[model samples]
Target: MSKGQITKARILHQAAELFNQQGYAGSSMSDVMDVTGLKKGGIYNHFKTKDELSLAAFDYAIATLAQHHRAVLRQHHHAADRLLGIMAVFSSFIDHPPVAGGCPLMNTAIEADDAHPALKARAQQAMTNLRKLLCHIVDTGIAKGELQPAVDSDVFATILISTIEGAIMISKLYDDPVHLERAIAHLTDYIDEYLRI
Candidate 1:
């Protein structure tokens, strides 16, 4: 990468961490400058405005998260195993998150609320992509005869994601991993008992 490319990536990464933790409205260019060791001019040279950086950082965080998902999912060929692997990946977030704050989707969704339309849309898109991934897994499982043919991929995916994301929120809230642990354990049992064929 060129010097400029490297610096821009650095800015994005640092800014992503800052924004994920502090949030868009709560964070400022000065905060980003402090974390990135870059001046206002330096930041603006790469991003036209804080909004631009905020969106870019969100994308960066999501990309990083997707990479983790790909890495873990690649190791499991069975659809059931892949779904379990996805749960494991989220379960690991308590100790080692892809980004600093939490699930970028959850964090962004909550903060974006109705205030930031652009960010709210981005979060929704990211979530939809995730749901699509789960649906794909379920569909593939059905084709492979590894899952029940009658399983509704859309509804199943929604339940899985909603359950896991809620567990993550609860775990993060009280600084307790048990909440996620219980969720993952139940999910694993549920998938094996109901989804697996």
Candidate 2:
């Protein structure tokens, strides 16, 4: 990569970590500059405004998370195991998070609401993608007779996504991982019920 590209990537990485640790409102360009050790002009060279950096950081975090998902899926072939592997990915996140800022979607969603329409839409799309991943696995299971065909893939996907997001929120607020574990257990059981049918 070019030197300029490397620096911009560094800036984005630092900014994403900060934004994940703190909400968008809590993060500042100066904070990013501080961690990045880049001058105002240097940071602005890649991103015109802190808002631009924030958007870039949000996208960076989501992309990183998606990469992890791909790795987990490749490691586990069974749909339920893949789903559980996803759970493991999130569960391990509580203990050893890739980015220090926390879940970008949860952080951004809680902060943005309707104010940042563009960011809110992006975050919603991330959530939708997550659901689709889960739904795809479950649908595959049904097709293979490993899961019951009577199950509603979309509803299941919705519940799994909601539970995961909600659990992350609770985990953050309570400073405990049990909320996340509960969500995973329920998700596993939800799948188990299908397997038994």
Candidate 3:
């Protein structure tokens, strides 16, 4: 990569961590400067505005998560196994999160509510993609007879995502891992008992 490209990449990495932890509204340009070691002109050279940087950082964060999910999903062929693996991915958020604060999707969704329309839309799209992925996995499982034929992919996917996200929120709130652990263990049993054919 060129020097400019490398600098831009570094800015995105640092900004992503900053935005994810402190949030877009909560974060200031000074924080970005501190994280990236870049002055205003340096940052503005790459991103025209803070809004632009926020959107880019969110996209970068989502891509990082997608990469991790793809790697784990590739290892499991069956739908149940894939779902379990996905859960394991979320579980890793406790100690080894892809970003700093918490689940970017959840964090963004909560913070980017009414005022930040662009960021809110991006968060919604990211969440839609996740739900679609889970639904696709369920569909594949049913087709392969790994999962029950009667399952409603939408409902199943919603349950899994909501439960996992909620657990993440609780875990982060109390700075405790037990809620996340129990949630994952329960989901595992839910998969084995209800999802498997």
lDDT tens digits by residue: candidate 3, 53-121: 999999999999999899989899899999999899899998999988778999999999998999999
Whichever of 1 and 2 has more TM-score, that candidate is 1
When summed lDDT is taken over every stretch of 10 residues in candidate 3, the lowest stretch is 97-106
Residue-wise lDDT of candidate 2 within 43-159, one digit each (tens)? 999998888888899999999888889999999887778877887778766877767756777788878899888788889888888888888998998887777778887887777
Model 2 Cα shift for residue 194 (angstroms): 3.2
lDDT of each: 0.93, 0.83, 0.94
Task: List candidate 2 stretches off by more than 4 Å.
Answer: none
Against the true structure, candidate 1 has what lDDT? 0.93
lDDT of 1 by residue, 13-103 (tens): 9999999899999998889999999899999999999999999999999999999889978899999999999888788889988999888
lDDT of the structure predicted as candidate 2: 0.83
Displacement of residue 175 (Cα, Å) in model 2 is: 1.3
Model 2 — which ten-residue stretch has the worst lDDT?
Answer: 188-197
TM-scores, all models, native as reference: 0.98, 0.93, 0.98
Q: Which regions in candidate 3 have their CA more than 4 angstroms from the true location? A: none
